[model samples]
Target: MELKKRIEKFKTREFETNKEFYLGIEKGQNPHTLFIGCSDSRVNAEILFQARAGELFQIRNVANIVPRDDDPDNNLSVVSALEYAVKVLKVKNIIVCGHSNCGGCAAIRKLNDYKDDLPNTAEWISQSSRISDYIDGKYPDMNEDNKLVLLEKLNAVRQLDNLLTYDFIRQAFDSRKLNLQAYYYDIGTGDISIYDYENEFSDLIKEIALS
Candidate 1:
Protein backbone atom coordinates (compact mmCIF):
# COMPACT_ATOMS: atom_id res chain seq x y z
CA MET A 1 0.00 0.00 0.00
CA GLU A 2 2.40 2.66 1.23
CA LEU A 3 5.99 3.08 0.01
CA LYS A 4 7.46 2.21 3.38
CA LYS A 5 5.26 -0.83 3.62
CA ARG A 6 6.42 -2.03 0.24
CA ILE A 7 10.06 -1.57 1.24
CA GLU A 8 9.55 -3.46 4.50
CA LYS A 9 7.86 -6.25 2.60
CA PHE A 10 10.86 -6.42 0.23
CA LYS A 11 13.25 -6.54 3.23
CA THR A 12 11.36 -9.38 4.81
CA ARG A 13 11.11 -11.27 1.54
CA GLU A 14 14.81 -10.75 0.82
CA PHE A 15 15.91 -12.26 4.13
CA GLU A 16 13.09 -14.76 4.41
CA THR A 17 12.80 -16.33 0.97
CA ASN A 18 15.12 -14.56 -1.49
CA LYS A 19 18.14 -14.63 0.82
CA GLU A 20 20.38 -16.61 -1.50
CA PHE A 21 19.77 -14.29 -4.45
CA TYR A 22 20.41 -11.22 -2.33
CA LEU A 23 23.51 -12.78 -0.80
CA GLY A 24 24.93 -13.61 -4.22
CA ILE A 25 24.34 -10.03 -5.41
CA GLU A 26 25.98 -8.68 -2.27
CA LYS A 27 29.17 -10.56 -3.09
CA GLY A 28 29.45 -8.79 -6.46
CA GLN A 29 27.36 -7.67 -9.39
CA ASN A 30 28.24 -9.26 -12.70
CA PRO A 31 25.48 -7.95 -14.88
CA HIS A 32 25.65 -9.13 -18.47
CA THR A 33 23.69 -6.22 -19.94
CA LEU A 34 23.75 -2.45 -19.61
CA PHE A 35 20.33 -0.85 -19.83
CA ILE A 36 20.00 2.88 -20.47
CA GLY A 37 16.39 3.84 -20.03
CA CYS A 38 14.15 6.83 -19.30
CA SER A 39 13.50 8.35 -15.86
CA ASP A 40 9.78 8.07 -16.46
CA SER A 41 8.22 6.37 -13.44
CA ARG A 42 6.26 3.91 -15.54
CA VAL A 43 9.27 2.62 -17.42
CA ASN A 44 10.95 0.07 -15.17
CA ALA A 45 13.73 -1.68 -17.12
CA GLU A 46 14.03 -4.72 -14.83
CA ILE A 47 10.31 -5.33 -14.72
CA LEU A 48 9.98 -4.97 -18.46
CA PHE A 49 12.81 -7.40 -19.13
CA GLN A 50 11.81 -9.70 -16.24
CA ALA A 51 15.42 -9.45 -15.11
CA ARG A 52 16.65 -10.66 -11.75
CA ALA A 53 19.11 -8.89 -9.49
CA GLY A 54 22.67 -8.55 -10.85
CA GLU A 55 21.45 -9.31 -14.34
CA LEU A 56 21.52 -5.73 -15.62
CA PHE A 57 23.56 -2.63 -14.95
CA GLN A 58 20.91 0.06 -15.25
CA ILE A 59 21.00 3.82 -15.72
CA ARG A 60 17.93 6.02 -16.00
CA ASN A 61 17.90 9.54 -17.36
CA VAL A 62 15.67 11.95 -19.18
CA ALA A 63 14.43 10.24 -22.36
CA ASN A 64 17.19 7.66 -22.01
CA ILE A 65 19.62 10.21 -23.47
CA VAL A 66 23.29 9.34 -23.83
CA PRO A 67 25.33 12.51 -24.03
CA ARG A 68 28.15 12.63 -26.54
CA ASP A 69 31.57 11.91 -25.09
CA ASP A 70 32.78 15.31 -26.26
CA ASP A 71 30.20 16.98 -24.02
CA PRO A 72 31.52 16.48 -20.52
CA ASP A 73 29.06 18.65 -18.61
CA ASN A 74 25.90 17.28 -20.19
CA ASN A 75 25.68 13.95 -18.41
CA LEU A 76 28.85 13.15 -16.49
CA SER A 77 27.12 10.53 -14.36
CA VAL A 78 26.00 8.62 -17.42
CA VAL A 79 29.51 8.69 -18.80
CA SER A 80 30.97 7.43 -15.55
CA ALA A 81 28.43 4.65 -15.28
CA LEU A 82 29.00 3.65 -18.89
CA GLU A 83 32.75 3.54 -18.45
CA TYR A 84 32.40 1.38 -15.37
CA ALA A 85 29.94 -0.91 -17.08
CA VAL A 86 32.01 -1.37 -20.21
CA LYS A 87 35.65 -1.03 -19.17
CA VAL A 88 35.42 -2.49 -15.70
CA LEU A 89 32.25 -4.56 -15.62
CA LYS A 90 32.69 -5.73 -19.22
CA VAL A 91 28.99 -5.79 -19.95
CA LYS A 92 28.50 -7.59 -23.25
CA ASN A 93 25.48 -5.68 -24.47
CA ILE A 94 24.07 -2.16 -24.03
CA ILE A 95 20.52 -1.06 -24.73
CA VAL A 96 19.20 2.48 -25.09
CA CYS A 97 15.48 2.25 -24.62
CA GLY A 98 12.96 5.07 -25.21
CA HIS A 99 9.29 4.98 -24.34
CA SER A 100 6.00 6.45 -25.60
CA ASN A 101 4.50 9.64 -24.08
CA CYS A 102 7.85 10.46 -22.54
CA GLY A 103 7.69 13.74 -20.64
CA GLY A 104 11.30 14.49 -21.50
CA CYS A 105 10.63 14.04 -25.23
CA ALA A 106 7.50 16.14 -24.90
CA ALA A 107 9.59 18.82 -23.24
CA ILE A 108 11.96 18.62 -26.17
CA ARG A 109 9.03 19.40 -28.43
CA LYS A 110 8.38 22.49 -26.32
CA LEU A 111 11.65 23.61 -24.81
CA ASN A 112 10.84 27.30 -24.81
CA ASP A 113 7.69 26.78 -22.78
CA TYR A 114 9.53 25.81 -19.61
CA LYS A 115 9.78 28.39 -16.84
CA ASP A 116 12.85 29.39 -14.87
CA ASP A 117 12.01 26.74 -12.29
CA LEU A 118 13.06 23.99 -14.70
CA PRO A 119 16.39 25.43 -15.75
CA ASN A 120 18.34 22.27 -15.01
CA THR A 121 15.87 20.05 -16.82
CA ALA A 122 15.89 22.40 -19.79
CA GLU A 123 19.66 22.30 -19.95
CA TRP A 124 19.79 18.53 -19.61
CA ILE A 125 17.62 18.01 -22.69
CA SER A 126 19.43 20.62 -24.76
CA GLN A 127 20.34 17.88 -27.21
CA SER A 128 16.74 18.04 -28.35
CA SER A 129 16.34 21.83 -28.21
CA ARG A 130 16.48 22.09 -31.97
CA ILE A 131 14.44 18.96 -32.62
CA SER A 132 11.52 21.03 -33.83
CA ASP A 133 13.61 22.50 -36.64
CA TYR A 134 14.63 19.02 -37.77
CA ILE A 135 11.09 17.64 -37.68
CA ASP A 136 9.67 20.62 -39.52
CA GLY A 137 12.23 20.46 -42.30
CA LYS A 138 12.30 16.68 -42.58
CA TYR A 139 8.59 15.96 -42.24
CA PRO A 140 6.78 19.10 -43.26
CA ASP A 141 3.52 17.25 -43.86
CA MET A 142 3.55 15.07 -40.75
CA ASN A 143 1.21 15.97 -37.92
CA GLU A 144 2.30 16.84 -34.39
CA ASP A 145 1.48 13.44 -32.82
CA ASN A 146 3.30 11.49 -35.53
CA LYS A 147 6.23 13.86 -35.35
CA LEU A 148 6.67 13.28 -31.60
CA VAL A 149 6.53 9.52 -32.08
CA LEU A 150 9.20 9.78 -34.76
CA LEU A 151 11.24 12.04 -32.49
CA GLU A 152 11.13 9.51 -29.63
CA LYS A 153 12.36 6.74 -31.92
CA LEU A 154 15.01 9.01 -33.40
CA ASN A 155 16.23 9.85 -29.89
CA ALA A 156 16.78 6.16 -29.19
CA VAL A 157 18.94 5.88 -32.28
CA ARG A 158 20.72 9.06 -31.31
CA GLN A 159 21.65 7.59 -27.91
CA LEU A 160 23.05 4.47 -29.62
CA ASP A 161 25.08 6.75 -31.84
CA ASN A 162 26.34 8.55 -28.76
CA LEU A 163 27.41 5.23 -27.24
CA LEU A 164 29.79 4.75 -30.16
CA THR A 165 31.63 7.92 -29.21
CA TYR A 166 33.11 6.29 -26.12
CA ASP A 167 36.51 4.75 -26.91
CA PHE A 168 36.02 1.70 -24.73
CA ILE A 169 32.65 0.99 -26.30
CA ARG A 170 34.08 1.47 -29.77
CA GLN A 171 36.97 -0.85 -29.07
CA ALA A 172 34.71 -3.48 -27.59
CA PHE A 173 32.36 -3.22 -30.56
CA ASP A 174 35.18 -3.45 -33.08
CA SER A 175 36.56 -6.49 -31.32
CA ARG A 176 33.10 -8.10 -31.31
CA LYS A 177 33.06 -8.09 -27.53
CA LEU A 178 30.19 -5.61 -27.13
CA ASN A 179 26.90 -4.96 -28.89
CA LEU A 180 24.47 -2.01 -28.89
CA GLN A 181 20.74 -1.86 -29.41
CA ALA A 182 18.09 0.87 -29.70
CA TYR A 183 14.60 0.10 -28.48
CA TYR A 184 11.29 2.01 -28.54
CA TYR A 185 8.51 0.99 -26.20
CA ASP A 186 4.90 1.87 -26.89
CA ILE A 187 3.40 2.47 -23.48
CA GLY A 188 -0.19 2.34 -24.74
CA THR A 189 0.14 -0.83 -26.76
CA GLY A 190 2.79 -2.59 -24.67
CA ASP A 191 4.80 -3.29 -27.80
CA ILE A 192 8.52 -2.70 -28.09
CA SER A 193 10.20 -2.04 -31.42
CA ILE A 194 13.89 -2.59 -31.90
CA TYR A 195 15.85 -0.34 -34.24
CA ASP A 196 18.85 -1.19 -36.30
CA TYR A 197 21.15 1.78 -36.78
CA GLU A 198 21.02 1.19 -40.55
CA ASN A 199 17.37 0.34 -41.11
CA GLU A 200 13.93 0.95 -39.51
CA PHE A 201 12.35 -0.34 -36.31
CA SER A 202 10.76 -3.80 -36.13
CA ASP A 203 9.29 -6.31 -33.72
CA LEU A 204 11.63 -7.95 -31.19
CA ILE A 205 14.05 -10.37 -32.82
CA LYS A 206 17.40 -11.92 -32.02
CA GLU A 207 20.28 -9.53 -32.64
CA ILE A 208 22.04 -12.08 -34.80
CA ALA A 209 18.98 -12.28 -37.05
CA LEU A 210 19.11 -8.61 -37.97
CA SER A 211 20.67 -7.76 -41.32
Candidate 2:
Protein backbone atom coordinates (compact mmCIF):
# COMPACT_ATOMS: atom_id res chain seq x y z
CA MET A 1 0.00 0.00 0.00
CA GLU A 2 1.02 3.58 -0.61
CA LEU A 3 2.39 5.68 2.30
CA LYS A 4 -0.54 8.11 2.18
CA LYS A 5 -3.07 5.25 2.16
CA ARG A 6 -1.31 3.69 5.13
CA ILE A 7 -1.40 7.08 6.88
CA GLU A 8 -5.11 7.48 6.12
CA LYS A 9 -5.86 4.06 7.58
CA PHE A 10 -3.94 4.95 10.75
CA LYS A 11 -5.70 8.30 11.04
CA THR A 12 -9.09 6.58 10.77
CA ARG A 13 -8.26 4.04 13.47
CA GLU A 14 -6.27 6.40 15.68
CA PHE A 15 -9.27 8.42 16.82
CA GLU A 16 -10.87 5.38 18.45
CA THR A 17 -7.77 4.76 20.54
CA ASN A 18 -6.67 8.33 21.22
CA LYS A 19 -9.62 10.68 20.69
CA GLU A 20 -10.57 11.07 24.37
CA PHE A 21 -7.09 12.15 25.34
CA TYR A 22 -6.85 14.48 22.35
CA LEU A 23 -10.36 15.94 22.92
CA GLY A 24 -9.56 17.07 26.47
CA ILE A 25 -6.31 18.53 25.18
CA GLU A 26 -8.20 20.72 22.65
CA LYS A 27 -9.81 22.50 25.59
CA GLY A 28 -6.39 23.82 26.58
CA GLN A 29 -2.79 22.68 26.61
CA ASN A 30 -0.80 23.49 29.72
CA PRO A 31 2.35 21.50 29.25
CA HIS A 32 4.88 22.18 31.96
CA THR A 33 7.93 21.20 29.89
CA LEU A 34 9.26 22.33 26.55
CA PHE A 35 11.21 19.39 25.16
CA ILE A 36 13.79 20.27 22.55
CA GLY A 37 14.61 17.11 20.66
CA CYS A 38 16.19 16.06 17.38
CA SER A 39 14.40 15.66 14.06
CA ASP A 40 15.56 12.03 14.16
CA SER A 41 12.57 9.73 13.81
CA ARG A 42 14.14 7.38 16.36
CA VAL A 43 13.87 9.96 19.13
CA ASN A 44 10.21 9.96 20.17
CA ALA A 45 9.77 12.24 23.19
CA GLU A 46 6.35 10.89 24.13
CA ILE A 47 7.49 7.29 24.23
CA LEU A 48 10.82 8.12 25.86
CA PHE A 49 9.12 10.03 28.67
CA GLN A 50 5.98 7.90 28.79
CA ALA A 51 4.04 11.09 28.20
CA ARG A 52 0.67 11.65 26.55
CA ALA A 53 -0.10 14.25 23.92
CA GLY A 54 -0.16 17.85 25.18
CA GLU A 55 2.06 16.87 28.09
CA LEU A 56 5.06 18.27 26.22
CA PHE A 57 5.45 21.29 23.97
CA GLN A 58 8.10 19.97 21.61
CA ILE A 59 10.50 21.78 19.27
CA ARG A 60 12.62 19.66 16.96
CA ASN A 61 15.47 20.62 14.65
CA VAL A 62 18.77 19.42 13.21
CA ALA A 63 21.00 18.05 15.99
CA ASN A 64 18.21 19.33 18.21
CA ILE A 65 19.91 22.72 17.88
CA VAL A 66 18.47 26.01 19.09
CA PRO A 67 20.18 29.04 17.60
CA ARG A 68 21.42 31.95 19.67
CA ASP A 69 19.99 35.28 18.59
CA ASP A 70 22.54 38.01 18.21
CA ASP A 71 19.42 39.29 16.54
CA PRO A 72 16.15 37.44 17.04
CA ASP A 73 15.41 38.04 13.38
CA ASN A 74 18.33 35.75 12.65
CA ASN A 75 16.46 32.96 14.41
CA LEU A 76 12.85 34.01 14.48
CA SER A 77 11.48 30.54 15.12
CA VAL A 78 13.78 29.74 18.02
CA VAL A 79 13.24 33.14 19.59
CA SER A 80 9.48 33.14 19.10
CA ALA A 81 9.07 29.68 20.56
CA LEU A 82 11.14 30.62 23.59
CA GLU A 83 9.03 33.77 24.03
CA TYR A 84 5.78 31.83 23.97
CA ALA A 85 7.02 29.03 26.18
CA VAL A 86 8.64 31.27 28.76
CA LYS A 87 6.32 34.32 28.74
CA VAL A 88 2.99 32.94 27.56
CA LEU A 89 2.96 29.20 28.14
CA LYS A 90 5.04 29.51 31.33
CA VAL A 91 6.61 26.12 30.94
CA LYS A 92 8.59 25.31 34.06
CA ASN A 93 11.50 23.63 32.33
CA ILE A 94 13.14 23.41 28.94
CA ILE A 95 15.12 20.33 27.96
CA VAL A 96 17.84 20.34 25.31
CA CYS A 97 18.17 16.67 24.43
CA GLY A 98 20.71 15.12 22.06
CA HIS A 99 21.21 11.52 21.10
CA SER A 100 24.07 9.23 20.05
CA ASN A 101 24.74 8.21 16.45
CA CYS A 102 23.18 11.39 15.10
CA GLY A 103 23.32 11.97 11.37
CA GLY A 104 23.36 15.74 11.80
CA CYS A 105 26.47 15.42 13.94
CA ALA A 106 28.13 13.23 11.32
CA ALA A 107 27.06 15.49 8.49
CA ILE A 108 28.84 18.39 10.16
CA ARG A 109 32.18 16.61 10.06
CA LYS A 110 31.86 15.36 6.51
CA LEU A 111 30.63 18.33 4.51
CA ASN A 112 29.24 16.01 1.87
CA ASP A 113 28.53 17.19 -1.67
CA TYR A 114 24.75 17.19 -1.23
CA LYS A 115 25.17 20.97 -1.28
CA ASP A 116 24.02 21.01 -4.90
CA ASP A 117 20.71 19.24 -4.18
CA LEU A 118 19.94 19.91 -0.52
CA PRO A 119 21.48 23.33 -0.20
CA ASN A 120 18.97 24.58 2.35
CA THR A 121 19.23 21.62 4.76
CA ALA A 122 23.00 21.85 4.49
CA GLU A 123 22.98 25.52 5.35
CA TRP A 124 20.42 25.12 8.11
CA ILE A 125 22.44 22.52 10.01
CA SER A 126 25.57 24.58 9.56
CA GLN A 127 24.45 26.22 12.79
CA SER A 128 26.30 23.21 14.18
CA SER A 129 29.59 24.45 12.77
CA ARG A 130 30.93 24.82 16.26
CA ILE A 131 31.01 21.05 16.58
CA SER A 132 33.58 20.89 13.84
CA ASP A 133 35.83 23.47 15.50
CA TYR A 134 35.60 21.77 18.91
CA ILE A 135 36.50 18.34 17.60
CA ASP A 136 39.06 19.58 15.10
CA GLY A 137 42.67 18.47 15.89
CA LYS A 138 41.46 16.83 19.12
CA TYR A 139 39.97 13.85 17.33
CA PRO A 140 42.05 13.76 14.21
CA ASP A 141 42.74 10.03 14.55
CA MET A 142 39.83 9.04 16.81
CA ASN A 143 37.49 6.30 15.75
CA GLU A 144 33.95 7.00 14.52
CA ASP A 145 32.38 5.95 17.83
CA ASN A 146 34.54 8.35 19.83
CA LYS A 147 33.88 11.13 17.34
CA LEU A 148 30.11 10.73 17.65
CA VAL A 149 30.26 10.86 21.45
CA LEU A 150 32.22 14.09 21.27
CA LEU A 151 29.76 15.48 18.74
CA GLU A 152 26.76 14.54 20.85
CA LYS A 153 28.15 16.17 23.99
CA LEU A 154 29.37 19.30 22.20
CA ASN A 155 26.08 19.78 20.38
CA ALA A 156 24.18 19.62 23.67
CA VAL A 157 26.35 22.33 25.22
CA ARG A 158 26.15 24.47 22.09
CA GLN A 159 22.37 24.29 22.16
CA LEU A 160 22.25 25.01 25.91
CA ASP A 161 24.24 28.18 25.30
CA ASN A 162 21.92 29.06 22.44
CA LEU A 163 18.90 28.55 24.69
CA LEU A 164 20.32 31.01 27.21
CA THR A 165 20.91 33.82 24.72
CA TYR A 166 17.24 34.88 24.56
CA ASP A 167 16.26 37.66 26.98
CA PHE A 168 12.97 36.09 27.95
CA ILE A 169 14.72 32.81 28.70
CA ARG A 170 17.44 34.56 30.67
CA GLN A 171 14.87 36.56 32.66
CA ALA A 172 12.77 33.50 33.40
CA PHE A 173 15.89 31.68 34.62
CA ASP A 174 17.12 34.59 36.71
CA SER A 175 13.70 35.06 38.29
CA ARG A 176 13.60 31.35 39.12
CA LYS A 177 10.56 30.89 36.92
CA LEU A 178 12.21 28.39 34.61
CA ASN A 179 14.93 25.73 34.47
CA LEU A 180 17.11 24.42 31.62
CA GLN A 181 18.74 21.05 31.18
CA ALA A 182 20.86 19.13 28.69
CA TYR A 183 21.09 15.40 28.13
CA TYR A 184 22.66 12.95 25.69
CA TYR A 185 20.78 9.76 24.93
CA ASP A 186 23.07 6.87 24.07
CA ILE A 187 21.38 4.54 21.66
CA GLY A 188 23.81 1.65 22.01
CA THR A 189 23.74 1.70 25.80
CA GLY A 190 20.21 3.02 26.36
CA ASP A 191 21.80 5.35 28.85
CA ILE A 192 21.26 9.08 29.24
CA SER A 193 23.97 11.41 30.51
CA ILE A 194 23.16 14.89 31.74
CA TYR A 195 25.77 17.50 30.86
CA ASP A 196 26.68 20.05 33.54
CA TYR A 197 27.59 23.47 32.23
CA GLU A 198 29.34 24.47 35.46
CA ASN A 199 31.98 21.79 35.99
CA GLU A 200 32.59 21.70 32.26
CA PHE A 201 30.09 19.06 31.19
CA SER A 202 30.40 17.20 34.47
CA ASP A 203 27.72 14.65 35.31
CA LEU A 204 25.43 16.16 37.94
CA ILE A 205 22.23 14.33 37.24
CA LYS A 206 22.17 12.90 40.76
CA GLU A 207 22.77 16.21 42.54
CA ILE A 208 20.28 18.08 40.35
CA ALA A 209 17.66 15.40 41.01
CA LEU A 210 17.93 16.15 44.72
CA SER A 211 16.25 19.51 44.14
Would you list the clashing residue pairs of candidate 1? none
Q: lDDT by residue for model 1 over 1-211, one digit each (tens)?
A: 9999998988887666988778878979899999999999999888889999889999998888888788757577998899999999999899989899989988888887764768888888877555545666767999999988887887787777678878889999889899888889998999999886556633211121231
Q: Give lDDT: candidate 1, residue 133.
A: 57
Model 2: per-residue Cα lDDT over 54-134, one tens digit each: 779988887888876773437677667778887889999888889988888877776666577777777777777656655
lDDT, candidates in the order shown: 0.81, 0.76
**Steric collisions counted per model:** 0, 0
Runs in model 2 deviating more than 4 A are 1-14, 17-20, 71-73, 139-141, 199-211
